[model samples]
Target: MKTHDLTSLLEAMFHQSKEMILFVDRHGEIVYMNAEAEKTLDLSDYDRNQFINICGHCMGMAASGDPDCTTCFLMSKEKLTFQVYMRTRYGKRVTYIANFQQIDPENNISVFTLNPLSELMKQQEFEHQKLLTQRIIQAQENERKRISRDLHDGVTQELLNVLLEMRLFKYTKDREELDEKIEDSEEMLSHLLDYIRNISVELRPASLDDLGVEAALKTHFKWLQKQYGILVDFNTNLNKKRYRPEIETVIYRIIQEAAFNAVKYSGSDEIMVNLKEAGSYNGIEIHFEIEDEGAGFLMGAEPKGSGLGLFGMHERISSVDGELNIDSEPGRGTKVEGYIPVGERIV
Candidate 1:
């Protein structure tokens, strides 16, 4: 085939593509764009002189004022291909897998081909669901571990001592001596049984069903104080005492996760938790905040967690139709904040 024929075929394919495509000059000015690019970007009366900066719009890319944008994936000329989100002229935000290549040798002009991020968006949502499921399973496993430990170390050991006493009573030759040992053994066993029952209830309290979020949090925080000895400055101002069961469960779980993370990760000595109506609205909102003078990290970078603690926290918060915000800086401090809307419930 002739070179002209090949070029025509390539142009035809480019025009027919569903993804947006554009070519930029040495100064990042738009020089050429395909049909799809015009349609997807909703660009008309193309301004060839306008510079293309991925951070200039609704894209997740850092804005001009952003400290990290200087070293961002969008501005890095070294990368030949990468993925990023961009805002279109139509004002709709989208993620795009973009390719940049230096095609012009003399002027250093480049070509950029972009594909829509629909697939990635779907994948991210699916992963979010999977993350939530994993979190629930992990929480269940952790509860089982605590329960098992309590049974083994507390009740089970006490019962074993009682059993030994019972055996001694059975072997005793004197009736009076046998009676005293038997009574003591019976009392010990009874106390052990009660201890095991209490442990079981703590793992999954029946009161959670009979009571509500406030009660459940009160009990959990009491345990938190006992276990960690950290003072939790907790306050709840509510118009109602109870909420939908699902909402209550979500708030309870988020608080539990936040409190646990604070104790485990935050080196600070105090934490504040608040629950009340958020804003000028009828909806009840619960806020769980863990503020500590501990080590913090940059957002969007990988979080330091033993397993899925951070992931699980995010998942649980999402499940409740809530938002989780983490603010931290190295040696400065860390804060985990969760907001749950009661009227707009999520499970």
Candidate 2:
């Protein structure tokens, strides 16, 4: 092919390419940009002759928030490729993989190319959701296995023992022996009833269905005090107000998990739980908060447990269009708050 034809073909390809391409001068001004570059970077409004520093669009290049022009690829003598975030004209931050090449060394001209990272980010988000689903399934299965073991090893075995004792009653011919066997059987039956009740409470307290969330929480806190010696200061202004079953369940579970985490890891003697109504006029929102003045873990650090508890809480809350916020710091305390919009209430 002739040299002129080759140059024309390359120019057409450059303008038609999806990636944003810019020709920058030595003074960091954008000398020229292709069609795709103008649209992607939202620079169509700016005149090409008017100098615009490229660093104004950068989201910093070092530890600080200020853009570091010294480390910019355009200033480097060698070619460079790296990831960077840029603020678009609409004020949205976008990630891009950029390549900078010194096209003309004598004239100090460089060509910069940028490929957006939106698709890569979407793929990552999808993979994260898949992992979350797997974790939820595993948690459910583990809980079922635990319940099964408890029933078989504890409740079922106890019942079998009671049955064996009753079989001995047939061999007892004396009235006194018969009376003694009957009393033993009665005591065993009573114990078995208590065990079953405990398991029922563990699964889902009957009070939660019969009364309301407040009553159920009181019962749970009382039980916690007796079992783990952790006192819970419970407060709620809802005054037995009822909500959709799904909302109630999500709030209950989130509080349950948060309180359990505090008791298990916080090492604090007391925790606080508060539930109230938030927002005004257009909508009503239910806000529940659990706070512990105990030893809290560092934010973003690996949790001591399976890390599924918080994840499950988030999943459950979000399912009901609720928001969950957790605040904690080492040697300080932890607070978990959730808000659910329950719509306008009837007067």
**Candidate topping TM-score:** 2
Give residue 330's error in model 2 in angstroms.
Answer: 2.2
- What is the C-alpha lDDT profile of model 2 across 1-347, one tens digit per residue? 54578788889978999988888888768878888867766755444443276766667453255445567676685555577777776767777877788789898988888888776678899998898788879889999999999899889998998999999999999999899999998999899999889889989988887777777888889989999999999989988777777777787889999999999999999999999987766588999999998999998999898799988898898898989999999889999997999885433
Q: Clashing pairs in model 2?
A: none
Task: In model 1, state the lDDT of residue 63.
Answer: 32
Off by over 4 Å in 1: 1-79, 82-95, 100-113, 117-168, 237-240, 277-279, 283-301, 310-314, 317-325, 329-347
TM-score of 1: 0.61
lDDT of 2 at 293: 89
Question: What TM-score would each prediction reach against the true structure?
Answer: 0.61, 0.77
Model 2 segments more than 4 A misplaced: 1-68, 78-81, 85-93, 101-112, 277-279, 283-285, 344-347
Candidate 1 weakest ten by summed lDDT? 49-58
- What lDDT does model 2 reach? 0.83
Candidate 1 pairs with clashing backbones = none
